[model samples]
Target: MDVSQVLRMNGGDGDYSYSNNSLLQREVITMTKPIIEDSLTNLYCDMNFPKTLIMADLGCSSGPNTLLVASELVKSIDKIRLELGNSNEPIEIQIYLNDLPHNDFNTIFHSVPKFQKKLTKQMTSYSSSPRCYVSGVPGSFYTRLFLNRSIHFIYSSYSLMWLSKVPEMINTNKGNIYMSRTSPPSVIKAYHEQFQRDFMTFLKCRSEEMVRGGRMVLTLLGRQSDDPCSKECCYVWDLLALSLNDMVSKGLIEEEKVDSFNIPQYTPSSKEVSNEVEKEGSFMIDCLEVSQVNWDASTDHNPIFSKEDAQGYNMGKCMRAVAEPLVLSHFGESIIEGVFERYTNNIKMSMSKEKTKLINVTVSMTRNG
Candidate 1:
């Protein structure tokens, strides 16, 4: 399928549309802002010297969160400028926001004015004039992203789990035949292998693109436990199963087909991701922390029980959002509306039962100097 077709099949519109600014506010911006800010601070302290920094935000879906990363980078650069006593000199900042070509660049482009306005306000607070340039580079993150040794800092949020493409074994009709969530062990294994291949390529490509001693802060949807079969580890799988079951019950799809399907590889545990990073031998682990995020707090003022609950909640919605298009592709447009309706209802049910919430692992690493 073409990029546009792939986008449409994935619920690229409707709830997943970039115009749904509230998702960016509640889902991406609030969650990513502090992490980016804090990570930038950490990286700044470790760098031996400050220089013109080129930063990239991978998988920067069109929304307010796109600007949040840029904002944090500019702020961090300003802080670095103050420390160097170079606040008087114009500091050059290059910011690249990346995503698939079909992503809503118009929304991203439209927000540039507001983002600049915010930057203008913030820069006015600083003692020196900061020269900041922002550009959008559209492409996949699984492959080469930048020029060799070009980027100083890289940040990606909620993007890595997507495999380069659906696994080839998904269509085979062994005991079970499926693509992402319901296939047999071999299918799941194939998906994981593909994930490993794609992830390693991503790291290796970035390693070449990043200057020595540069840092990357990546937050991805992940499982708490090492076990791949654990419900917490596979919450998205469970949700997809629930949604598929509903489709079958409604006679929209075949039971055997639904049972055989598997989801694209995701929910890699902290250990799994760390192992891959270590094995790749391109980066030194600085900090790897897997904690749950409180997404309910974004909606209500009340504090949640644990980080895992919040993360599960947030992740569940994100999974549905990304999978919305897939469902449309497998099923038909008529079922798209009901699919989301049921999918969201399931998320609310899971939340009320305190079953799952948004969870993620934040990893910060620097290229071996």
Candidate 2:
């Protein structure tokens, strides 16, 4: 599958849309809110604060989380300006919402008027209620998206875990969608190598675009353990693979096709993340945190619905939002519903045994001169 062209959350406000099923992502954002506020404070106080603040949210997919970040940023800048007694400076906040070209930019644009109205209502009397210009920039974050020293702060949420592309020459990890305990060391190495290369390129591009002392806050799916195939990181994919294999046994899909399919994703450990930042030589890690997030945080389970089944169904919807497009691209759309139904059932069965969660890492960095 063409990762850049095919991978995106389900667009619009449909039942399965990412906008509707992104509570887990919302929790991640909420967990990292303090870090974001602190980073902006440092940007204003430690560095020479720019009257024209240039900010970008890389991989800002279409969802409430997209505008949530922008809105919080404007509030933070306004608060800092008030505290610094620069309320009359007339700050110009230019927020660039970035994602792949195929992302739902229209949905985001449609919500702008409401977002602006809400933002204006929140501004205090002391501040000039900064003028915010929001625009969509379509492209990959692994390559340059802006000119040199143009951005002051960059915030990305739950996006960097995706590799630019799946690793090359992995003919060994058969029947699995991601790294598994049964995967050979070569398969593990291949994924880590791909992640390292992609992450380095990401830092290089951001380094060129951010001014000296600029700050960045990125939250991505990751792991706490040194093991590459930890249950925390791989169980969700493993369950999905199990569902696919079940379909194969039922003669619903070709075994060979299952063998060839893999997700273009990797969950980095904290050490690996810090090592990359150190190796890239462009940014200094200010704060790095790993939060263990429950898989069922977004589930809307009720007394009428079995808790385990409801949680599984909600997770299925969440995964369907993010992975359905890619799965459809590879397997044809005929089996989409059947695949996720099996996936939901698998999750239900597994949750009956034990609960599973994901490790989300939020890293704050400052551009080094």
Candidate 3:
């Protein structure tokens, strides 16, 4: 399957739109807000207050989250400048929001005016208004998109775990959709090699596009252990695989299709990420932090705990938003609901036995000569 063509969060403001179901991503953004603020502040300091700041948010899926990033960044810079008390020389900021071509750029564009309006209001109290330019750049980040040495800072959240494509030789992972405890060494090696290639390409492209001392903050779902098949990393998919297999048993879907289907994603450990950066030789890893969040944390906002399906369904909703397009493209839309329904049931059962959490890895890197 051409993942680039099919991979996208469900679009539009309907029930499954990424906008509504991206609470998990929002939680992630909130968790990493301090890291983002610190990085932006440090980048500004390292660049010596350049007249123009070029920033890009890679894999900026459509929704409030995208604009929130831009807003927070503007606030960070404004805070720094306000402290400096420079009323005469405010910086010009250009933000390029990037994602796949199939992403809902229209939704993001429609929201940009509101974003700009709010930004203007926020800047009114500051000494000088920083001219902010926001535009959508639709493309894959695995390849070069920006001009050479043009960007000063780049940020990505809840992305980069997705591979450019599924491993070319995943025949060994017959019954699984992702790496699992049962997956063989060959399957693990294939995934590791793909991540290395893709991440190195990412570094090389960014190195060319960013000026010296440019910095990047990336947040992705990753494993906490060296083992690629660690439960925290692959358990979700293992449950998903079980759901597919159950469907196959009931004749809801084909066994061969389930066996052949592999998600185009990989969760790397911090060591794995750091090793890649060192090997690429163009970027220096400044900080790497890992945190975990429970699967049911979404329900914290809702006071009345009246539903048994809350936790599982909440996670399922988020997962559906992210992977529904791919699932629909491959299996047809008829089974989408049923698949997730069964998947959530499995999650509900598992949650009773043990708490399931996903690891969030944040890495801060600086460009080197």
C-alpha RMSD between model 1 and the true structure? 4.7
Q: Which residue runs does candidate 2 get wrong by more than 4 Å?
A: 301-304
**TM accuracy, model 2:** 0.97
Identify the superior model by lDDT, candidate 1 or candidate 3: 3
Winner on TM-score between 2 and 3 is 2
Weakest 10 consecutive residues of candidate 2 by summed lDDT: 300-309
**Number of the top-ranking candidate, with TM-score as the measure:** 2
Backbone collision count in every prediction? 22, 0, 0
Q: What is the lDDT of residue 52 in candidate 1?
A: 63
Candidates 1 and 2, the one with greater lDDT: 2
* Model 2 lDDT at residue 242: 93
Tens-place lDDT digits, model 1, residues 3-112: 23454212233544443323423454455556666666656666644556789988787666678768877877787667756667666778998888867677778778
TM-score of every model versus the real structure: 0.83, 0.97, 0.96
Segments in model 3 whose C-alpha atoms lie over 4 Å from true places: 124-127, 300-308
Provide the lowest-lDDT 10-residue window in model 1.
Answer: 3-12
lDDT of 3 by residue, 6-118 (tens): 99998888866888777778888889888877877788778887779999999999988999989988878888777766557878899999999999999999998889888
Predictions ranked by TM-score, top down?
A: 2, 3, 1
The CA lDDT of each predicted structure is 0.67, 0.90, 0.86
Candidate 3 least-lDDT 10 residues: 298-307
